[model samples]
Target: MSTEVAQNTLSSLLEAVQPPNGGRNIHDPATGELVARAPEHGTEELDAAVAAARAAQAAWAARSHGERSEFLNRAADAIEASAEALAELLSREQGKPLNGPNARFEVGACASWLRATAALDLQPEVLVDDATSHAELHYRPLGVIGAIGPWNWPMMISVWQLAPSLRMGNTVVMKPSEYTPLSVLALAAVINTELPDGVLTVVSGGREVGERLAAHPGIDKVMFTGSTATGKAIIRSSADTVKRLTLELGGNDAGIVLEDADPRAIAEDLFWGAFINTGQTCAALKRLYVPESIYDEVCDALVEVARLMPMGNGLDENNVLGPLQNKAQFDIVARLVDEARAAGARVLIGGNPVDDQPGYFYPTTLVADIANDNSLVVEEQFGPALPIIRYSTLDDAIAMANGLDVGLGASVWSSDPAQARQVAARIQAGSVWINKHGAIDPRVPFGGTKQSGYGLEFGVDGLKALGAPQVIS
Candidate 1:
């Protein structure tokens, strides 16, 4: 899309969601400027959306998978056409810069993921093909899906939940994070243009509405991405109804650097892995375990890289990092970093937030010489602060990395591919990268192992997660 067209589309989407009269006010985290007001929907609104989705599911499911795939492809096309507008709005609301793997990249990922999901084939498997008896395992849509998304990577994660659900012929009623409703609303509006009415709806409501939706009899399944605390609540709410769930929850991910790894060579990737989205990512590397031999070298290299990366208003094209999406998150990050500082952790780069800054802009901080038991090292800071812990042996490093309760993702960095893979295998996480961290793809399956939450998402398994399996004989 052209610049003028994109701007026009963004303006229209903003105006449509923000009626002059009502709704909750939303501000840009990067600048504290009024971006727009999202519709403050309540339980009544959620119930209506769920009803609409329930009414639409059978007809949607009745269509052949090929027919559904065609609609998804069209949705992808619409998203691509509105990609720039979506990215601009996402940057403003979610506090991610348009540059780098932040806003624009997220919007692009939404489209690509949709297309990739559409292309995936989930054919029924033949259990037995003998002349006397033949059986086949098939999947069917599970009515309406209640999809709850997070503030960080709002658009992309919503796509991660909804695309496959829709492909499997399940209608979806999405409740976006209170922190970022406009982005998801706009995204759903664009997608709804291609889909049949009531097939997909967005209920931009609060906590009560989400709770009701999880327990609502109409909703057959719930897909959530957020904190482990909330994930537990959803699990309990959905228990009585026995609603199927696919949760991608909280993660205190770790990254391990072997003695043989070159500090300078891997520093840039390590920096991005931890600091992406200003380090608000669930699967982002929160703790770093480095051998005592190269610990100082790694810290220096990370400090060198972190200082160069610009942190400013998301609207500024030059700035790659932005503020925490909300004050609560800002407080959490600030408190943890402060606690780490008080405990004598060496602040190699940034540990201070500019008091005069208008927005929730916590500076990019790298805390080194920190013990494994330090609050910053043990807890999921979910901010731009990274705690680098020193260890003596590879076994100790691995143990420290796996000590956390939550394990969504982890990484092992080494020169040798075999060594990296072997080390990666030992880390307790849903997904582990050999030399990279949080490099997720649509084609691959992803989920957490322990407290990180369960039920797989993405790829064929993700599609199946949205469906009801049956064996035909």
Candidate 2:
């Protein structure tokens, strides 16, 4: 679509969602300018959406898988058609640069995920077959699915949950993060163009609405992606209804640089892995452990790469890094870096925020010579700050990497894939990368171990997660 058409589409979507008396005003995190207002839905609206979804589920499920897949394909087309408009709105509201692997990448990901989910083969399994008797295992839709998404990658993550649920023949009722509700709402508006009425709906509200939706009798399953604390709360709330859940919560991922690794060769990848989405990614590398032999080398290489990346307003194509999505996140990044500086850690580059800056723009910070127990190293500073710690031995490095209670993802960087694989086997994370960190593929299953939360999210398993298993003879 042309830029003019895309803008018109976005404007129409915002107008449709805005309440008559106005609703919550969303502002640009990059410049503190008013972007738009999102509807402040509550429990009543939640009930109506769920009721409509529940009413639509049976007919949606009754259709053949091929028919459902076709609908998903068309939804993907609609998302692509409005890709430019969606990216612009997402950049303005979510504080991600329009270029690079930020807003446009996220918008494109939504469409790609839709297509991937639609194309996945999910045939019934022949559990048992004897001469006189036969049995088959099949997956059926589980009524209405409640998808609660995070703000970091609002549109893409919503597709991660919504596409599979819809493809499995279940209708979805989504509750987007309050910080970036407009992005999700706009995305739902584009997607709804290709879907049947009530097949998908977005309820942009506060925590109460989410709490009610999790426990609501009409919602058979809840798929949530957010903080660990909120995931725990959902667990408690959903218990009364015995609702099934798939939670992808907080991740303080770690990365290790082996003694034999080439620091210069891996510096750029390491920097992007940790700082992608300006470090708001749950699976982004929060802690780095480097052997003393190449500690300074690795730190210097990372600093050099970090210095080249420009940070500014999201609309500026020359910039790759943007502000934290909200003030609370900015405070967390600022506070953790401050604590690190006070604790005598060395700031390599971009530790201090520009006081005169208009928005919540914390500079990309890299701290070295930090202790493993330091708050910055231990905590999930979901922003553009990385804590690099030095270790004397490989054993010490492995122990420090595994020290955290949450292990969603971890990476082992080395010249020898064999050695990396050996080290990877010892780590406790759900997904371990040999050379790259947080390189998630839609075809691969991704989740977390321990407090990072459970249940797989991609590939065939992700499709099955949204369905109820039954055996027929």
Candidate 3:
């Protein structure tokens, strides 16, 4: 379909799906335009979506893995075909740059993940071949999965849940965050055209709808990606139904720069690693721990490169960075940066928002010589502001990095790969990187180790997370 046709179709569909109570308005973070409306679906809508999923689950599960995978592949193909239009919508709604490794990149990731997961194979395990009785562990689909996606990297993350769940033969009723619901809606609208009516659905809303979906007994599994606090609430609600859950929650990821590493050599990589998607990424490097010997140099290297990276509206292809996606997030980032500055943290670069900007556009901020206990260093400032702290010893650096309750991801930068791996092994996180941070593969499992979240996504573990393993003798 043409871009104009797709836009009109999406608008009509949005109008059709809008809740009876005139749902919440979704605004473009760059221009503050009323981009779309997220239907404030509540208990009734949640139940209806889950019921549809349940009705479709049987036929979907009855299909062979190959058949299910084919559907996923078709969806991926559809996504790639309409990528430009989708990426444009994503940039307008998500506030990420459309080109130059931003929204377009993310939309590409969604297609890649869907196609990859579709092509992936998982065989039933034979456990006791030599014994008197033979045993086989078969992965069977759960009835219906309730997937709640966060706003940051909305399209890719939703596919991270939907692709695997559908590949495992489970139908899904998804709830994309109200902040950026249009992307998911547009994506699902395209993909669902190829699949059965109830196989996949998107219900847009805030907390109430999500609560109902998690608590409802119709859903066999709840796969949520969002805040730690919200994850806890889902846990409490899902407890009553004893629903299986896979939560990918918050992260205050830290990256350590060793004295042996070249700050200038890795400066650009480090900058993108932390500030990709304007640092709204859950796995982005929020805190940088630099050795006292090279702390100043590392700070200077980051600021020098960060200043050159353009920040503007996502539609402008020249802009590598875009505005914060929402006002709440912008305020949070502002408050944290201001508090850190008040606490004697040195602002090495852009510390303030673009004065009187149309939207929530904060500058690429770098806090130097900040104490580990400072809020900017301690909390997850999910924006472009990064805090670089000085550490005297490796032990202290590791301690400071591991001190936080959130441990989604961490990285070590050093000249020696082996040495970096040794230190990486000491850090408590789900994924650790050497030289780079947040470069994930579709075949590798990605998850968190502590309060960040539980259950894995991607690879064999991800496939199994959507199903029940039944051992047959």
Q: lDDT by residue for model 2 over 166-224, one digit each (tens)? A: 99999999999999999998888888877789999999899999999999999999999
Tens-digit lDDT track of model 1 for 91-208: 9999999999899999899989999999998999999998799999999888899999999999999999899999999999999999999999999888877889999999998999
Q: Which is better, 1 or 3, measured by TM-score? A: 1
TM-score of each: 0.98, 0.97, 0.96
Clashes within 3 Å, all models in order = 0, 0, 0
Q: Which lDDT values do the candidates have, in the order given?
A: 0.91, 0.92, 0.89
Every model: Cα RMSD to truth? 2.2, 2.1, 2.5
lDDT of 1 at 97: 93
Q: 161 in model 2: Cα distance from truth in Å?
A: 0.5
